[model samples]
Target chain A: MVTLNNFRKHYKDFDLNISMQIPAGTVTGLIGRNGAGKSTTIKAILGLINPDEGEVCVFDKNPREFTPRDKEAIGTVIGGNLLGDFITAEDTIAILRKMYADFDEPYFRAQCKALELPLEKPFKDLSNGMKARLRVLIAISHKARLLVLDEPTAGMDVIARSEILDLLREYLAQDGERSVLISSHISSDIEGFCDDVYLIERGEIVLHEDTDTILGQYGVLKLSENEFRDVERQYIVACKKEAYGYACLTKEKQYFVDNYPGIIVENGSLDSTIILMLGGR
Target chain B: MRGVLEKDFRSYRKTVLLTLALVVLYAAFCCLMPGFDLVHSVLFVGWMGAVAAVNEVADDERNGYAFLMTLPVDARSYVLAKLVYVTTVQVHFWILARVTLLVGTLLDGKKPDIPALLSKGLALHFGMVALLMLILTFVIKFGVKSILYLAGGLVMLVCVFCVLVVTKPDANWVDALLRIGRFPHIGIYATAAAIIATAGLTRLAVHFMRNKEF
Candidate 1:
């Protein structure tokens, strides 16, 4: 649904160089630490800011050139405070209904009602979790073909997060072609909800693979100093010294299991993978 | 554009109400005060319109302009909507000011100087439109925070120019202003010029907004 080709943007303290594709009918998660260019990449894709070089295409057209009709196919939930303090939920719905021809007002109201959001309360008066839910509700209620969510579940409790994830699952299930690109710091959410994941560090894409591959085929092998020295180097993608010994990330989990019978191997997770890949060697 | 205008209206509802109340109070004051000149009231109305425009711009900034950009509207449309809203509010205030002046004059049992009223009202209206357009351009170019510095700098510049004019040995500039006011056609010409200038400024604002990074 969206593609970034050699996208480059330079800031005073950092430079973002990213290339990725978010295919249709799949949930793609972008995981990165703060200042890792996640938001910058999203901004460039949204045409909120122009990149110094390269191109971003959404639905085969540059976002900078998107007409209102083209934009109606995309929805977004950006992080931080969005609505003004004076605007209430009712006012938001009224405004959005006029802005989007396909805006599903009933769906939005139903979602808000289900979430127990006060329709008359000003946005500033809502709790952080409520605000997050409201953003998600608005994004999904527009009947958009793609939903670009940045930290959509941030500040929400476990129950709220679970509910939102379920809502996204249902939303995708309703249409085979709908897609989502979500960026969040919470690895568990990405692991649980995403079909594919991209690990970004210092504006560079370190890894992009299917979630199943990361969880099943990739692994971390725990070894003592002596054992680590004897282990084959070809299987290790990244390694980090630990308090007990060392942990090495391996893409070929079967090779490690078959060759090293006594080695301790644990299933790879997004968090552990990021730590080994981004942490100092 | 309608969405944008509606958002602004709801956001500024309180301020609009406050402005209306102030206009009513000022009109009442004008009716009671002996030898009350409507020119000062016209200027006050102009200031009120400017205040509304500035407040709307500030509110949009504070409300997260980035969020607005994410909507299914382009930057040009956003800028145009703001221009339309500000112009509508200014026109509304102008009508209110005219009605107040006329009612006050009638209540005071005075034969209103129709020509003088038109001359001052038209001048004030033109000035307000120019001021609003300039402000909109600045807001689009530099964001809302710059408005304070811009307004302060403009006030200082105007003050310096006024001082220079008052201290000048020649009275020609003052005489020229008086002479222009005497010609009723000058009001129509100034109105036409103000409209043209506002249209040009709106186009400039749209250009600035198109290049602006959220």
Candidate 2:
């Protein structure tokens, strides 16, 4: 369980004010574009950056005040390259084994082998996909109750990405006590795995709701110039216009589809929904 | 804590080895060359301090190992681990120096009392470690290169002051060290205690770093 209450952090150029909660036994996705403060949110939660205001608690304990037991229950992977270029996968495992008492070494080794990561090669020597997989393997091997991942699949190929997704699903399925919070630019990954989605824009949360509910409710409305001119302003959430037509977006996609049967309708993907909600695709 | 130290050890193995080799070569050169005991000791201390200071400052964060920040490791443990590593490296170099000195004396048929040498070395070792710890605190608080520049300037200032102090007809090098190294044993103890206290302050810095949102 994690809770952030009116958390605010400010830099010279950027600011973050967020209020969020991740309930136990549920996967939450943090969705945002580049420079949208997704990483800042994760950093604030990890206590890597002290919040200028508000509070963050993990399993009811503040990150700054976590007891040993509380810390032991949490694991985090903040980057696709958790181990630096000079460190090898074997070196990472050895160091982790000593730091985390509950680390499952054999299981971790098996995962590494299956993932085809070279244990003895330095991290810089590995491909980006290999490094990403290795990072996930390290985080999951800790036997932690909560796993926080930031862009863990950002550099992987389609197959590698699917493998990671499958591994995460398997983790949730087998371990009922565990919860996950993963942030990625890939909207489909978030849609496929996250139970709830948090869409952030310019350091503020725009929406937090069930992934399916948001996806099902929003759609794009393609209109010719005359039709766009005739449409109600209030109904159009966002519109990208050109000489040929206007591509209008609306939150009441189902209503638009049923009422305007003659108009063209396309099933809205998560990406489009975010683009509309954030007012930028 | 053991984990942190082990990782630091493995990570900086190259630097540690190189430092050891340099210390041995310097000590041997000091013994072989005539009348350089005091200069050798001071240079040895300075060299070891510089190496320990740089390694302490740069090895972790520069190498992208800040993910260690996510672990349950306490700030105190991180500082202690660094101190332990510097001290361990110091001990290894000290042992190598003693062995080299003993072998040199054996070949020359001039055996100094081992107990007396050991006592002096132990005192010097504790003092050197304390110095390294205090210097490392500053290095971590500032950037390594900045600290190195500041230290160099300070050393130059001290050398200038020493020359100013000993501009008399009979002020030899031995007299200079004797005059300089002479504060009471209490002064050394007090300085060592201050160094150890700085380690606590460095822990707070680590906490600030860990909690820094980046």
Candidate 3:
């Protein structure tokens, strides 16, 4: 279990006050716009940066308490270059084998083969998608108890993306209690694999719920200006008034669907749902 | 720690090979050149430390190799590994130089100011090594380029001081250093021990570095 308790960090332009719990044995998607504190939150949990307030515990252990052995339990690929670009993939594996007690050479090699990443090539020489795959492969090969990946598919083509997702799903299915936290800007990728999604806007978690619950419960309700004036405003999260009248985000889609027979209500995609929930006003 | 250390060494194979080549080339000069200075060992050791420390510090972070710093490896272990690497190279070159100089002296069938030069050289080398170890530790902790600029500034400052030292005919720098020579009989042994002890101080430096966050 990964618990983020009232985690707060402040910058001159932004403040991140987020709290969330990620259950074990499930893939939790951290969905946010760029600079929405997703990477900052991840960096805090990884101990790359210290938080101003709040605590993070991964598997009941504070990240600050992380020893080499404790770190071996977590595998991660962040947005920035994680490996030294000069090292060949083969050299990287050899070094990782020494750092991780559970590093399986055969598994790493298999992943490389599956991904078709040349072992002898320097990391700088690999294409961005290939590098992303290699990073995932290396992290996964450690047999980590927790996998934290940030934008693992950002540069991947459809074929490579599917293969990577397939590998992640396979890894998740092999064990009943493994956990993963993935952050991506592409809503479709998150919608494809994540059972739950945490939507962050301007450093705050605007919505945290199971993927189906959000997609099923919240929707865009379009209505005429005169019609919206008569409807109760309490249930409308935010409304955009236009020439056609008003398009509002309703917290309870079913209620609007049942109450406003004449209003236009439609199921929203993850991207629009996030946009409505975050930047609706 | 060992894992990261191995990784650091493996990544710098080219640099290591180059340093070794320099050491060999200098050792050859000591053996073949007339008026051969046994200070060859000291010079080689200093060159090794400078090359290894500067190269590692300057390139690692810029190349984005430091992403591994987030892993469970202690920052100090990372720093210590560099110190250990530099010291190891330094000691190897020192021993090789000493052995070569000893062989050259035996073949010449004469004691050629080896005792005096060795004694003074050892003291200066060890003192410089102690200071270099500390400097490199902080360099690894802070940004490397920042350290390089600082080092460059320091070198320019030292160059001015060297000019002063050289121009001052009244300045008895050699005499001042050699005053600590108590027993001329064991001078060679004492010098050897000083060089070895300088290598030992790196352990203290490594301990300090292991606890750092960078």
Candidate 4:
């Protein structure tokens, strides 16, 4: 549903240049650290920023060329409000109902109530968790075909984060054709949700693998220096120095488990993959 | 555009209400208070329009200007909606101003020439209100801080208009509008020019907003 061909944005100290795609009917996660260009990529896809070079296409058309009808299918939550702090959540829902043709008012109000959001409170008065919940609610309230979410769970407690993810899970379950591109600095936030994961570091994609492979097949082999020399090096995706031995990141977790009985193989997560890849040789 | 207009109307309803109260109170002042006349009241109405438009634009930016841009509405339609809302409110206030003036003159035991007064107010405000609305496009682009600078420049212009109002009211630029009404041939030309200018400025505002990053 979204494609970026050599998309590049130039800044004084940071340059974002990457090629990526999110097919329809898939939840793709763009995981990266803060200031790692995740938001920039999402902005380019949403036409919030013009690419300094290359093309960004959504629904097979340049976002800038998208008509109002074209945009109705997209729902985005990029850590911003609909109106300023002056309007209440009720006012926001009213505005959204006017803004979107397919806005499900009953579903939205029910979700708001389920989430314990105060309907009449101004947005500025809402707590951080409430504000976050409200943003996600607005995104899913409309029956959008594509959701481009940038850091939807940035600052929240574990329960709040879980609640936000549950909202997305519920949204995804409602429609098979609906797609999402959720970016975040927290690996665990998108780890269990996304179908495939894209690990970005310093505006570069270090790895792109399905969530199944990352969780089931990938592993980190902790071995002593002498044992590392004896172990197969071909499957290692990344290697890092450690106090006791070496930590090797490999996509073929079962391969090492079958061969190297002495090397400790731990199931790989996005967090370990990022750590090993970025800090490893 | 309807969505954007409705959203703006509801979001900025408070500002509109305050503007309504101010317009009513000012109209009464023009009738009962010494030294408060049509010229002063018209300028004040124009200024109040600026306040309402600027306040709404500021609130939009402070909250989620970027969020609004992500909506189905294109930049052009969004800008057009804002322009329409500002002008519509200003027009309503303007009509109230003229009605108040008419009643005030009639109630004070003066034989008011209703048609002439109405036409004269129309001729004066068409250009005045349009000018203020166009200037307001700057607030939408640069945020509310720009309003202080814009108001400063406008206050200087208002000062000049006040000088003209006292010394050469018949010879001032406002009189040019009255003269255009006297000559229907010139009225068409002036109107076409005004329409072209408003459209051009609105287009320019959209262009500035098209690539804006949230």
Candidate 5:
């Protein structure tokens, strides 16, 4: 649903150069450390910031050229304040109903009730978790075909996060053609929810893999210096030298396990996998 | 565009209402006081419109301009909506000023100079609208903080000019201003100039906003 081709944006201290695609009917996760250009990429895709070079296409149309009707199919939940502090949930709903022709007022109110959000309270008075829920609710309540969520789960409690994840799952199930591009600092949420994941470091996408393949096939092989030297170099996606020896990330876990029985091979979690990939040797 | 206007109106409902009330009270006071001048009373409408315009811009900036940009509306539409809102406020104040002046004249049991009242009112209205358009252009280009500083500097300059005029009433610049004020068709010309300037500044503001990021 979204394609970014050789996108480049230059900041005073940082330069973002990235290229990626978010296919329809899948949850794509963009994982990166802080200042790794995740939000910058999101901004570029949304046309909130102009890229120095390259192209971004959403639903086969340039974001800058999108009319209000074109934008009606896209819902966005950005980090930080999305509305004035004095605006209440009721006010937001009222305003959105006028802004969007397909805005589902009943669904929005129902979601707010389900989330126990006080409709009359100003946004500033709400807790961070409540704010997060409200933002996500608004995004989904617009009958959007594509949901672009930037750190939607940040500042939420465990229960709230789980509820939000469930909501996303339900939303995807409701429409087979719907897609989502979510960026979050919480790796486990991405691991559990994403169909595909992109690992960005210093404004560059270093890795892109299917979540299932990463979970099932990827492994970390810990070895002594001699064993590391003997191991085939092609299987090591990335390696980090440790106090004892070296930790190598490999996609051919079974090959390593079956061939090198003496080496310690463990199933790699998303956090450890990213650490190994981003942690320069 | 309607959505944008509705949001602004709701957000500034209290401020707009209070400003209208204050302007009305001040107009009444001007009419009742000894040596009351309808022309001076009408000038208050301009000041009130200026205050309302500045407050609206300040509130929008303070609230979440970046967030508003993320909405479905385009930048041009956003700028147009703001202009419409300000114009609506100015028009409402203009009507009030005219009505109050008319009622005040009838109450005083004197023949009202309808043409003079209209000329004065039109001049002030157009001038205020022009000033507001310029301010909006600056605010859009340079942001609220820079505009606030500019406004402060202008106020200081105006104060100094007033003091100079009071101290040297016969100075060359002061005499020139007095002569311009006494020009037979000055009001109509001033009004026309202000209207033209307002249109030009509004176009400039729209162009600046189109290029602005966030």
Candidate 6:
């Protein structure tokens, strides 16, 4: 549903060059460290910021030239750009009702009631969790075909994060053709939720893998110097020297378990993957 | 654009109501009190319109433009919506000012001649709103500090005007206003000029908003 073709954005101290595709019916997670060009990529996708080079296309049209119909097809919860803080939930409902032609008022009201968001209370008065919920609610309630969520669950407790994820899960379950591209610093959130994850560091896309492959097939082999030297290195995606010996990130976890018996074949987690990819060779 | 206008109205509803209430109370004060007349009504309308427009601009900035840009709105639509909202606020006050004029005439045992009062009041209201648009379009471009500067400048001007008023209480302000009001179709021309100026301002604002980073 969204495609970036060698998109290049250059700031004074940073340069971002990325190409990726988010097909319909998929949930893609963009995992990154702070200042890793995640927001810039998102801004480009939303047409909020201009790219110095390459193309950003949503539904086959440049995002900058997207018409109302194109915009209505996508929903967004961009960071630093949320609903008016002084307006109430009822006011949000009213505003959104007018904004989106297919905006489901009853659905929004029901969800608000279900989420325990006070309709009469001003948004500024709502708790942070409530505010987060309202922002997500606004994005999903309009029946958008694609959701570009930029850290929608940021600054929330675990439970609040789970609730936000649950909302997304419910949204995805309802439709197969709908897509989501969520950018977040929280690995665990993206790890357990998204189907695929793209690891970005220092404004470049370092790794992109299916969550299943990252979780189930990938492994971190903690090895002695001799063991590391003797082991086959083709499957090793990244590795770093440790005091004990070396820590190697391999895509073939089962191969190591089968061949190197009793070795420290720890499961590859999002966090470990990030550390190795970003901090290791 | 309709959606943005609706959101603005909803956000500023209470403030609008309170301003209108002030209008009624102030209108009554001007109508019955000794040194009050059309000029006071003009000043009140102008001040309230300027305040509402600036306040709305400030609130939108505080709210940030991220949420606004995410919607099915382009920069042009966004600018148009803001212009419409500000104009609507002024129109609400303008109509009410006519109401106050009618009530004043009834209390004075004369025919409630609203048409006679329409042109002068309309021209002044539009002129003030136009002046505000001239300020607001740039305040929008330059962001929050410019708004604060604009507010500060307005306060200073008002203070200076107040000082002038206090020092020259004997001056025939009413007669001067009457003479200005009698200028041939000055109201019609002012309204037309304001509309064209505002339209041009909206275009300029659209350009500014487009080039602005969220």
The most accurate candidate by TM-score is 1
Clashing pairs in 2: A48-B211, A48-B212, A48-B213, A49-B212, A49-B213
Q: Clashing pairs in model 4? A: A84-B63
Off by over 4 Å in 6: A241-243, B105-113, B150-188
Model 1, position A229: C-alpha lDDT score: 91
Better of 1 and 6 by lDDT: 1
Q: What is candidate 6's TM-score for chain B alone? A: 0.80
Evaluated against the true structure, the overall lDDT of model 1 is 0.84
lDDT of 2 by residue, A195-230 (tens): 899989889998788887766876788888777777
lDDT of 3 by residue, B1-214 (tens): 7776666667677457767677677766666777776565556656565665456544555654335755667655665666666565556555655666676676557675665434434544444455556566555456556666767888998887667667774668644644545546454665566566545645654554444332
Q: Scored by CA lDDT, what does every candidate get?
A: 0.84, 0.73, 0.73, 0.80, 0.84, 0.83
DockQ metric for all predictions = 0.64, 0.47, 0.43, 0.55, 0.53, 0.57
Candidate order by DockQ, highest to lowest?
Answer: 1, 6, 4, 5, 2, 3
Model 4 misplacement above 4 A: B34-36, B136-149, B152-194, B211-213
Angstrom error at residue A281, model 6: 3.1
lDDT per residue (tens digit) for residues A9-106 in model 5: 88889999999999999999999999998988888778777778999999898887777778788888886566666778988988998899989899
- Give the per-residue lDDT of model 5 (tens digit) for B1-214: 8888877676666467888888878877977886687777777877787787677665556654655666788767877777787778778778888887887787788898887666566777778778877887888888878777788999999999889899999899888976898888888899899989988988898788777766
* Tens-digit lDDT string for candidate 4 (B55-128): 65556666657677778889888888877876776677567666777766766667888765665445334454
Ranking by lDDT: 5, 1, 6, 4, 2, 3
Residue clash pairs of candidate 3: B76-B209, B76-B210
Where is the poorest 10-residue window by lDDT in model 6 chain A?
A78-87
Q: Kindly list the per-residue Cα lDDT of model 2 for residues B116-211, writing each as its tens digit.
A: 445444455555565565555554555445566767987998988667666753668646655656755644575576567656655655654444
DockQ score for model 1: 0.64
Name the lDDT value of residue B128 in candidate 2. 58
State the lDDT of candidate 1 residue by residue for B13-132, as single tens digits: 756878778878888887788898866777787778777766776676666577677888887787778877777778787877777777778887878877655555765666676777
The window of 10 residues in a row where model 4 chain B has the poorest summed lDDT is B120-129
